[model samples]
Target chain A: DVKVTQSSRYLVKRTGEKVFLECVQDMDHENMFWYRQDPGLGLRLIYFSYDVKMKEKGDIPEGYSVSREKKERFSLILESASTNQTSMYLCASSFSGANQPQHFGDGTRLSIL
Target chain B: DQQVKQNSPSLSVQEGRISILNCDYTNSMFDYFLWYKKYPAEGPTFLISISSIKDKNEDGRFTVFLNKSAKHLSLHIVPSQPGDSAVYFCAAIRQGAQKLVFGQGTRLTINP
Candidate 1:
């Protein structure tokens, strides 16, 4: 079975605090993605990494950065957490193919105060 | 603009009945469509998918139908059970692309 694990299930941070969300996938997939899900906005991609040390900005990448130092682990970083940055953060991984399905983690619900 | 839309925010169905969830997309270039089911607090799970070449695909009690001319798709779950209750999201991807555009999602409730 393919499993993706996030570092935290729930987080509360103050404004201007630096926050880090970690993700790890056991399937050895080549692609890793970070997304923030809002109530009516669905899932908005923040960043994605196709290979180690390679990253691409997604639709809403303004306040977030990502790190992919290893194949199994991907990290999402918030430079300066703001109240608007609070949302359910999701991490997903998929193999390199046209018809591949992305495997997702449980997600971290982050709240900025 | 939302490339994919699931306008129906929620739906109710009796057990053993067929539940149909609809989705629409504005992007004409999307050739691959996927459906995912998500329970509260958990991530979405891949349900089924269909390619542009095929109008319909079925696996067990779940069937996905695509209407290219209307830019719409639907997922039919036969004999829906209480366990089938979840939020369903429809996503689309263009040919040879890595990113998937998602819908706002529709919550399905199966009553016993």
Candidate 2:
């Protein structure tokens, strides 16, 4: 079984603070992705990394960035957390194929005040 | 513009009955479709998937049906149990795109 682990399960941040969400996968998957879930707006991709040091912006990339310094680790950064950024953040990892199933970690529910 | 759509926001079904969830996509480039089940405060989990070339795929109690002409897909879960209740999301991906387009999920409630 693939194990994807997020650093935190719930987070609280103040406005303008830089927030970091960490994710690590044990399956040695080549692809890592970050997404946010909102009511009525399913899961929207924020960023994705196909290779180490290579990243691509997803549909909604504003105010967020990602780092994949290692193949097994991916990190999502909030430049300056705002109230609007509060949502359930999820991290997923998959083998290097479009058809491969992506395994997800338990999400981190973020709250910005 | 939303490329993927789930017209129904929620569905209720009696336990042991068949639960069918529908999804539609506007992108012809999509070559694969998948269904994910999510619970509160947890990330979505892979449930079932079907290739665009094939019309149907089944796994245990979950079956996924795809219609290429209509650009639509559906997931049927027979003998639905209380544990089957969750938010179901339909997603699509084009060959080599690596990006999955997801539709607004439909919440499934199984009533005894």
Candidate 3:
């Protein structure tokens, strides 16, 4: 079984504040991803890391960035939190293969006021 | 442009009945499809998948049927249980592509 752990399950931040969402995987997968799940919009990818120090922007990358200093850890940074940024954030990891399934963490529900 | 689409936003079914969810994709380059189930406050979990070469794949009570000509796919859950109630998402990936395009998702509710 693969274990993907997020630093926080619930978060609250004020407008203009910076936010950090951390994720760690135990399986040492080479691929890590950050996504935001919204109603009627599905899971939109924010950022993804294929290897340590390598990152790529996904569909919705504005106002967000990512860090992959190590193979087991990936972090998402919100430069300036806003009310619209409040949503459920998910972290997933997978092996570097064509059809490999991604394992996900429980997710963090973020609230920006 | 939305590459993948789940037309049905929600579906309700009895515990012992069959529940069928449908998905469609516009991109013909997609060679692999996957289904995921997500519970409230939890991330989406991989349910089942099918390759373009195969039309059907079955696991336990869940089965996925794909129609390459129609560019559509469907998931059927037999003898649906309360535990099957969740948001189901359909995703697609091109051959050798690392990213997956997902549908909006369909919420399934099972009535006891």
The numbered model that scores best in DockQ is 3
Per-prediction share of native contacts kept: 0.63, 0.76, 0.74
lDDT of 2 at A107: 93
Residues B1-112 of candidate 2 have per-residue lDDT tens digits of 8999999999999999999999999999999999999998788999999998899999999999999999989999998999999999999999988889899999999999
Error of 3 at A98 (Å): 0.9
lDDT of 3 by residue, B1-112 (tens): 8999999999999999999999999999999999999999888999999999999999999999999999999999998999999999999999988898899999999999
What are the clashing pairs of model 1? none
Model 2 misplaced regions, further than 4 Å: none
The iRMS of model 2 comes to: 0.9
Q: Which CAPRI level is candidate 2?
A: high
Q: On a 0 to 1 TM-score scale, where does candidate 3 land against the true structure?
A: 0.99
- Every model's DockQ: 0.81, 0.82, 0.85
Query: How do the residues A1-113 of candidate 3 rate in per-residue lDDT, one tens digit apiece?
Result: 99999999999999999899999999989999999999999999999999999999999999999999999999999999999999999999999989988999999999999
In candidate 1, position A109 carries an lDDT of 99
- Please count the clashing residue pairs in each candidate, in the order shown: 0, 0, 0
Ten contiguous residues with the weakest lDDT in model 2 chain A = A95-104
